[model samples]
Target chain A: AQSVTQLDSQVPVFEEAPVELRCNYSSSVSVYLFWYVQYPNQGLQLLLKYLSGSTLVESINGFEAEFNKSQTSFHLRKPSVHISDTAEYFCAVTRGGADGLTFGKGTHLIIQP
Target chain B: NAGVTQTPKFRILKIGQSMTLQCTQDMNHNYMYWYRQDPGMGLKLIYYSVGAGITDKGEVPNGYNVSRSTTEDFPLRLELAAPSQTSVYFCASSYLESTGELFFGEGSRLTVL
Candidate 1:
């Protein structure tokens, strides 16, 4: 069984400020990690993913996450955020052959103007 | 691009009532999944299908049933609605396994009273 833990339930940051959402996972086997973002009244969209190779993965929108195997963490970070970045972010994990991803409790990113 | 589509964007069901949430994908992906999202609880997988005619249970499949009759359609049925089942349901698909990115539907919000 695999599990994901997102320590922050909510994170508030002013416009142009940097933000980091912490995520950690526990799995007996090698796992793939992903970050998904959901805007108000919309479905989730893939932000980025860490499947293999380089430890750092980035999304087109300027968000990036690093896969740290030693620490079992994949934390999302953005140097600066905008009002449009306010949304619920979820961290998920899956073993390569699993049926579905195991998601974290989610972290609501609240960006202030 | 009409990616994944989920019907009944919002529905209200009385206790003991039954309803089916429809999902369709135009991407021709071999893997489809159903997940429910609760506030502060992220998303929990209910069921998944590897391809047409093959289905399996996920983390939370007790109160729900699913059928994948074709590559494009995977419908989830709630036999007897309950307040505990009040949440937003999302349908997603991926060409490969979790190693690939997932495309999601806009989601269907269901409320049971």
Candidate 2:
């Protein structure tokens, strides 16, 4: 079984400041990686994903993650964050042929103005 | 189109009570999933369906049951609720075109008293 671990439980940053959320995974085979964000009282929104191809995947909202196969990690980073970017983030992974992703404990991103 | 939908946005139940979380998708997706989100914990898969008739247990499915009778409906049943089961639940669907991008519903908040 594949598992994901998010090192940080909470992250607080000033608006417009850069931020990075660390994620590591445990899997012996090929896998897919994903990052998802959940705003307060809302469902999850996909931030980015790395399935195949270039290891660095970008999202529309200025978020990006680099899949480091050597380290078995996919960390989400943003050069600058907004107040609206404050939310809970989750890192997930799935094996090559599996249909579901295994998720890590979330990291709460709090943007302070 | 309504991507994914879950009903009873909020519910409170006594221990040992029973309830069913309703879910539906209108995007004609072949894959549907049920997930539970605990505070500070990322979403955990409870159940999943490959199509209308094939349902399977996920990472955390011991206390839950699910059925997929139609392409659009997948209901999660909690036969005997517990405080440990209190969490926000989400329903999601995705196309096979991608293994990591899923469309999620707003979510259902369940509390066990």
Candidate 3:
């Protein structure tokens, strides 16, 4: 079985400040990691994913995440956050060939302006 | 293109009432899924379909039913709504399996009293 965990329930950061939302996963087999963003009253949008090759992946809006094998972590980071970035972020994982995903509770990224 | 579309942006129901949440995707994705998001929690899978005429339960599917009659339409049915079923419902589709990078619809917010 695979499980994901997001340590922080909420992360408040000032505008233009860097922030990090930590995610960890436990699985017996190979896995793929993903970070999704949900704006207010909206569906989820794919922020970034870690399939293979690069341990570090980035999104278009300056969001990035690094996958650590030894620590079983895939923490998301943003160099400069904006007020618009205030949203709920989710960390999810799936096995290489599984038909479903296991999601973390989520991290509410509150960008203080 | 409308990646995914869910009907009835909002709905209110009483105990034991029944309703259907409509979902459609223009991407011709073979895989479709339904998920529910409660307050302060990540999404939990409700139902999934690999293709037309095939459906299966997800993490949480006690109060929900679904059918995949065609590639574009995957509707979720609530047999007997309960207060616990009050939440935001999401429809998602993916071109392939083994990845969590699915395209999601806006969502359907349901409030049961």
Candidate 4:
């Protein structure tokens, strides 16, 4: 069985400050990684994904996550955050041939203005 | 296109009541999924369908039932609502299962009293 772990339950950062949300996964087979963001009262949106090729995947909204196979980690990062960036972020994993994804307990990124 | 759409954005039910959450995708995606989000729990897959008439249980499917009669519709049914089932329900769809990005609906918030 595959499982995901988000190390931080909450990440508080000041506006314009760098932020990182840690995630780790355990899977017996090769997996694809993804980062999803959810705003208040909304559904989750795909922030970024690591399917193949580049280990570092980026979203258009200045968010990026690196997939480190050796460490079983795919941490999301942003150079600077805005008040609008305050949301819940989730890390998910799906192994080869799987039909569904396994998600971690999300990290609430609170951007302090 | 309305990538994914879920009806009844919010609902309140008494214990032992039954209801169905309707989901539809106009993108003609072959894969559809149901997930529930709770505080700090990110999202847990409740059920998934690879295509019409092909449904499977996901990580958390104990109290839910689903049917995929058509490619565009996948509805989740709760036999007997419970307080534990009070959460935000999300419906998503993707073109493929192996490595496809998911498009999600806004979500349905359900409160069981």
Q: Which candidate tops lDDT?
A: 1
Write model 4 residue lDDT over A1-113, tens digit each, in one string.
Answer: 88999999999999999999999999998988999888988888889999989899899989999999999999999999999999989898887343677889999999888
Q: Is the docking of candidate 2 incorrect, acceptable, medium or high quality?
A: medium
Q: Residue A65 deviation, candidate 3, in Å?
A: 0.7
DockQ-better candidate, 1 vs 4: 1
* Candidate 2: count of backbone clashes, pairs at least 3 residues apart or interchain: 0
If the candidates were sorted by their DockQ against the true structure, best first, what order would they fall in?
1, 2, 4, 3
Candidate 4's C-alpha runs over 4 A off are A96-98, B97-100
Runs in model 3 deviating more than 4 A are: none
Using TM-score as the yardstick, the better of models 1 and 2 is: 1
TM-scores for all candidates: the values are 0.97, 0.96, 0.96, 0.96
DockQ of 1: 0.74
Per-residue error for B86 in candidate 1, Å, reads 0.7
Predicted candidate 1 versus true structure: per-residue lDDT over B1-113, tens digit per residue: 79999999999999999999999999889999999999999999999998999999998999899999899999999998999999999999998644647889999999999
Q: Summarize candidate 2's per-residue lDDT along B22-92 as a digit string, tens digits.
A: 99999998889999988777888999998888998888998899999999999999999999999999999
Instruction: Name the 10 consecutive residues with the lowest summed lDDT in model 2 chain B.
Output: B93-102
- Segments of candidate 1 deviating more than 4 angstroms: B97-100
Q: What is the alpha-carbon lDDT of model 4 when measured against the actual structure?
A: 0.90
* Backbone N/Cα/C clashes per model: 0, 0, 0, 0
DockQ scores for all predicted structures: 0.74, 0.72, 0.69, 0.69
Q: Spell out the clash pairs found in candidate 3.
A: none
Candidate 4 clashes between residue pairs 3 or more apart in a chain or in different chains: none
